[model samples]
Target: MAIAAKHNLELKQYDVTNAFVHASLDREVYMRMPKGYQKPGTILRIKKALYGLRISPLLWQKDLTATLTQLGFQIVPHEPCCMIKDGIIIFYYVDDIILAYGKDQSKKAQEAMDQLKQRYSITGGDDLQWFLGIEVIRDRSKQLIHLSQVAYYEKINRLVDDQTIRHDTPMATSELMPREGLATPSEINRYQRKIGSLLYAAVNTRPDIAFATSRLARFLANPSQEHQQAADRVLLYLSDTKWLTLRLGGGTAMQVASDASFADNTLDRKSSQGY
Candidate 1:
């Protein structure tokens, strides 16, 4: 997304229908026929890869990598899932592919996509809007791109009851100490679920909650009411700032800042650092 915004490029998404079924099998495999499709006392030999098999993903990846490489797309050394040739970049994740290219190279990108469409049942040729639950909004005129998870946040919010209170910060200023007693089974399960959801949001677009989420995660083994309240505070904060998004491509220069504290962790008494 940042690359698209930086180059003022158009982003296109494509989905390969029945992607796993397309890859040819390289080994002998057999499966029992369905109750209705069974021949009398006979099993079926597997031809194409099936979805449930463990090796299916490997077969698909090998096939895709071979095909893309044959078409002159080079696999990025640092990011194996990314394929690039000229100015056209293709980011492949399983069956989903995102194409990014500048206006001048749009034809080349389309041609590559067309070649893939010829081989597989491709379903998309529209502007990139949503992928992996992240909403992408681009503004070419202003040279900015925003990534948000409002829908995901709302979905998580629905998991819990409505809250009249909202928080400005994800966590309180005071540090949290480990509770004295172990949480009940149900309490532990619920706390872990909430932490998992919040962690996803943090890793995706809500970096503001990253520290709080991480801290809460430490108590997942035996969460307490106070810890649960901290988790709720994070959710309340999300409810209030659901519209917050990560913006990219405002400037060319890269900037970095660092800070550290000695023995900040109350439990471990270790220095904490961040950038």
Candidate 2:
């Protein structure tokens, strides 16, 4: 949706039929019959890509490229996973495909989708509300794409129900620093697992918790009471920012910055680093 809103392009989706079976095999293989064959020594020769093979997906992609090229679609020179024809562009990640074209050229784009459907399954073209866990909201007139993680935030809240906890800073100032021989082994392990989940969310859709999550993660091997307090603080913070969103700007670049503090550890007098 971001790409469509930014470039005024229409989107479509397609799925390949038995994608792995299209691969041509040079080697012969045989498998035992499944309980019904009369001859015990009988063997079946393999001619196509099979499940669990390491090269099936790559081979399927090659077959797809050849087929699309024969239909006059030029693969994108820089991106082997993308293709173009006239003004229409399609970007493919594995089997999921996203189509982009001018607003006036929607019919032609549908024609292209139909051709693809003749060989594959075209699942969608309109009202794509969600993709890859990011909620997509499209504003046609404003030409904007808004991606939110309200669902993710709700999941966090359910996991850590701290309704009475103060909606203050995620990590208290005291817990920001580390001390030697403070955290027990069991406590450290449990806290580390919780902080790891928060880190994943921070990286994907919750930048607000990055600082606190990183600070708590540092003490994973020896999490003290301070670390536990800090982890709870993040839960408190989430209580208030559950609906917070990172908007997709009209022309914004996805850039990130990290910083470290020298001698920020009050307990051990150690410097702090962040990414």
TM-score of each: 0.91, 0.66
Measured on C-alpha atoms, candidate 2 has an lDDT of 0.70
CA deviation > 4 Å runs, candidate 1: 26-29, 39-41, 161-165
Query: How would you encode candidate 1's per-residue C-alpha lDDT over 225-254 as one tens digit per residue?
Result: 788888888888887898899998878898
Per-residue lDDT of model 2, residues 1-275, tens digit only = 45578775666555555667867765666666667665767877777877667777787788777766766789878789788888788777666667778879888888877877776554667555665666777776777777676776566554453355565566665535565676767786668767876876688667878877876777787777656656766866765776666655376567778887888766777886766
Q: Score each candidate by Cα lDDT.
A: 0.87, 0.70
Q: Give the number of the best model, judged by lDDT.
A: 1
lDDT over C-alpha atoms for residue 196 of model 2: 74
Report the lDDT of model 2 for residue 151: 76
TM-score attained by model 2: 0.66
RMSD of each: 2.0, 5.0
